[model samples]
Target chain A: MADKVLMKGNQAIAEAAVQANCEFYAGYPITPQNEIPEYMSKRMYDLGRVFIQSESELAAINMVFGASAAGARAMTSSSSPGISLKQEGISYIAAAELPCVIVNMVRGGPGLGNISGAQSDYFQSTRGGGHGDYRLIVLAPSSVQEAYDLTMNAFDLADIYRNPVMILGDGYLGQMIEPLELKEYKKPANLPAKDWALTGCKGRKPHVVKTLYLIPPELLIKHNIHLQEKYGRIKKEFCLYEEAETKDAELIIVAYGIAARVCKGAVLKARKEGIKVGLLRPITLWPFPEKIISDLADKAKRFLVVEMSMGQMVDDVRLAVNGKKPVEFFGNAGGWMPSSDMILDKIKELKL
Target chain B: MAAIGTAEIVHAVNRGENLTFIFVNNAVYGMTGGQMAPTTMLGQKTTTTPYGRETKEAGYPLRVSEMLATLDGACYIERCAVNNAANVIKTKKAIKKAFQNQIDKKGFSIVEVLSQCPTNWGVTPIKSNEYIEKEMMKIFPLGVLKDKGN
Candidate 1:
C-alpha cells in the first residue's frame, strides 16, 4: 500500500487536483466547499501555478473558461448557491466543448438554506444544470478516499470527452476526515492533444473558441448534433457503479455519495436479520448505470432509493426501473442525513 | 462591452488581473429594440424610457470608468470618445496603452469608449456622432480618470 495520510475530504480533493497537474484554478469562497479554493490558493502559489480568488462565482467560472481555452487544465468549485451563479458560464463551457473540472460541494439549498451536506443537486448536476441540451460527466464520491480518487480521475475524464466533468459532493463528504493513500500520479496513456486550444496563431490559423453560432439556423443545429453524438459515445463507453450482494437479494437500495454510505450499513443489518437486501451505488451520476438497474429490476422484487435530498435521485431510479418493479423512496433534506437504523426501519416497513 | 456585467467589472478590478476591458458605452441597448442601459444619459429617451429617463425613475448614468478607478487594484482607467478624427486617434492610443499595461503585467486596465447607437437612438449616423460630441460628452467626460503607472 502507498503511504497513507489522514486528510479532510476537501483538502484531499484539492491535493489530488494539484497532483493531476491542474495548472490554473479560480473560485469564490462559499461554505462547505471553501476549503478547496483555500487549499488551492496556498498549494498552487507555492508551485507557481495560477490561482485567483476570483471576485465572484461568475468571474471564477469565466476565468476557468479562459484558462482552459489557453490549453491549461483549469478548475473551479463552489457550493450550491454559488454553483447556481456559475450555470451560465458552465453552459458556455459546455457549448464550446472545453474540458474543465467543476466541483460542487453541495450544501442544503432552494436558496441559502444551510451550509450542511446534502444531495439536492443530483438533478441539477445530471440534467445539465445550465440552460442547454448538454450534460456534465458527474461523479459522486461517497467517502474521503473516493473523493481523492475521483477528483484525480475527473481531470482526465474532462480531457477525454472535451467536456466539463463535475465532482458532485455533499457538505459531509467535503468536511469528512479519513485515511487516504497518496497514490503516485500517472498521466493516462494516449490522451488526445488539445489541438483546438487557443495557444496563439503562430505558424497556423487561429482557433476561435466560442459558443455563438449565428446566421444560418442549420449551423447551430449541426453543432448541437455533434454535442449529442459525443454524449451518446460517453454514455455507451463510460457507466460506473458498485454492487454488493445483489445476486439473490429480493430488495435493493439504490443510492450514491453519502447516502450510499449510510445504506451500506443498513444493508448489512438487514442481512444479519436474515432479510435479503442489497446495495447498488452509482458512481457516475450522469452516465447513470441505468442498464444495471434495469437488469436488476427483473431479479429484485423491489428497490429503495435513498438520498439526503428530498427525493431527487429517486426520479432517476424510477426511470431506470421503468415499472418492472415497485421503487420506493426514502429521503431527508436541509442538512439532515438518514441513519442506518432509520433506513433499516424503512426496509422493515416495506416488509422485505 | 456592456454595463450589464458591472459586477464582473468590479470583481476583475478587485483581483488586479492583467487584462484589458474595452467598454463601449452606447448609452442604450442596441439589440432587442432600444432600451435604457446603465450608461444612458439622464433625460435620454429610448424605447423603454419613452418619457425621457427621469432621475427619480431611472437614476443617474453609470460612469463605469470613474467607479472602477476608485479600486486600488485598478492600474489604469480612461474614458474616451470616437466621435471625431482627433478623438478617434486618442481612443486608439488609450486602447494601445491599456494593452501595453497588460503586457507589462500591470493590474486591471479599462478603456471606456463612449460610442453612438444611431439606429437605437433614432437618429442618422452623422447625427449620432454629433450627439456623442455635443450631449454625451457633457455627462461622460473624456479623459484619464486614473493612471497608476504614470
Candidate 2:
C-alpha cells in the first residue's frame, strides 16, 4: 500500500529526493524555496548523508557537480537570481554529461526580481540559460503531486540522459500543500565504475572529464555533433504533454506549470459557458510537444499561449503552429500571477 | 617568503586538504580600478572615488572573517595583519592555527590577513603598510572571533 500524507510541495520534493537515494545536497537558502534545503539539512543530516550549506549558488552547483561526477545522486536548488548565478556551473554539468537534478522554484526574474510565483524562467530553463548548444530535460510540474513525482523522475531522467534535469516550479507550487501518495524509495543501481570520477586512481587509469576541447576546430565540431545527436534522440523519446478536453474544441490553450493549472480552471469555466476550449500542457518544455501542437493547429482555429512571463513560450507556440493557426499570447510578468478569471476573459475575448 | 590574500585563499581552499582563509582589510578593492568589494572600507578613495567614500553614498566593507565565523561549518575565525614582522609572525600563527583546525576536521576556518593595497591607495607599498598599521588596525582590530579549540 502507498503511504499517503499531506506535504508541502517543497517538503515533498525533499522527501522524494531522499527516496531516490540522493546522497548529496548542496545549496544556499533562498525565499519561497528554503524549505527544500532546510528539510534536506535536517533529514539528510539524520541519515548521515552529505549536505553542505554552500557559500553561494555558484559553490552549491559546483559542489553538486563534484558529487555527481563522483557518481553520487546529487541535487541543488534555488530561485531565479540564484539560478542565474548557477548558469555557468550548469553549463559545465551539461558539457561534462554529468547526471544531476536542479530544482528552480522560480520567482520573479531578470534581476533580484521578487519572491513570487512566476513562470518567467521558461526560456531560461528550456533554452539553456547558459551559453551552449545544449538543452536540459526541463520538466514543469503543475501540481504538488508532480512536485514530488517529478523530482523522483528528475533523478532517473538525469541519470538516463547523462544530462541535467530541471524540476521547474513556481513559488506557489513550492509553498502549496497537497496530499500525495509517496512512492517507495528505490536505491539507485550501482553505477558502472567510471574512470572520470575523482576517486583515487587505486591502480586504475586516470580519467579527465572536461569540456575544454581547444585542440582543433574539427574535433570540437565533431563533439558538438555528437551532443546534438544525443539531444535529437532525447527530443524524440522524452517529449510529453497532457491534453484536456481536446476533442471538438475550437480554441486550444497552450501553457505549462502553474499557468497550466490556471488555464485548466479557465478552460473548465469556459466549457460551462458553451465555449469549446481545451488545454495542451507541455510537461517537458524542451522536447516541447511540437508535433501535438502542429496536429492541433489543423483542427483548432485559435491558439492562446498563457504563461507567467510575457509571451516567452509564445515564440515556441508560433514555431509549432507554423502559421497554420492564429496564435495569441497573454501573460503577467515579474511575479504577478494572472487569476483564472482573467484567463477566462482572454479566452472569451479571443472568441474562437 | 611569500604572501597571499583572497585569490590565494580560494585557490588554497579548493586544492589543499586542510586549509585556512586570510582576508586583508586595506579598505579597497585593490585590484582592477579599486572600485569597491564586499569588504571595501567605509571611507576610502580610489580611481572611481573622486571624493572619499561617503558613508551615505557607499556602505561599509564587510568583515569577511566575522561572516565566515558565523557559519556552523567554520571552525576558527581570526583577523591579523602583516604591518610589521612581529604582526606578520602573529598572522602566520593564526594561519597555521586555522589550517590545524581544518586538519583536525574541526570545520571551515579563516584568517584575515589585513594587509595594504598600495597601488589602489595611490601610495607606495611601504607607505600603504604604514597606513594599515596606523589607520586600518584601529577600525578592524585583530583577534580570534571564533576558535573551535580542537
Candidate 1 per-residue C-alpha lDDT over A147-200 given as tens digits, one digit per residue, 9 for 90 to 100? 999998899999999999999998999899999999867899958999999998
Indicate the worst ten consecutive residues by lDDT in candidate 2 chain A: A187-196
What does the lDDT come to for candidate 2?
Answer: 0.81
RMSD of model 1 against the true structure: 16.9
Residue-level lDDT tens digits of model 1 in B65-141: 88889899899999999898999999999999999999999988899998989998989989999999899999999
User: For model 1, which pairs clash?
Assistant: A117-A171
- DockQ, candidate no. 2: 0.03
Q: Model 2, B54-136: lDDT tens per residue? A: 45433465566665555555567788888889998998888888777777766567777887787778789899888887777
Q: Could you give candidate 2's per-residue lDDT for residues A296-333 as a string of tens digits?
A: 99999999999898889899999999999899989879
Name every residue pair that clashes in candidate 2. B21-B111, B22-B111, B23-B112, B23-B113
What class would a CAPRI assessor give candidate 2's docking? Answer: incorrect
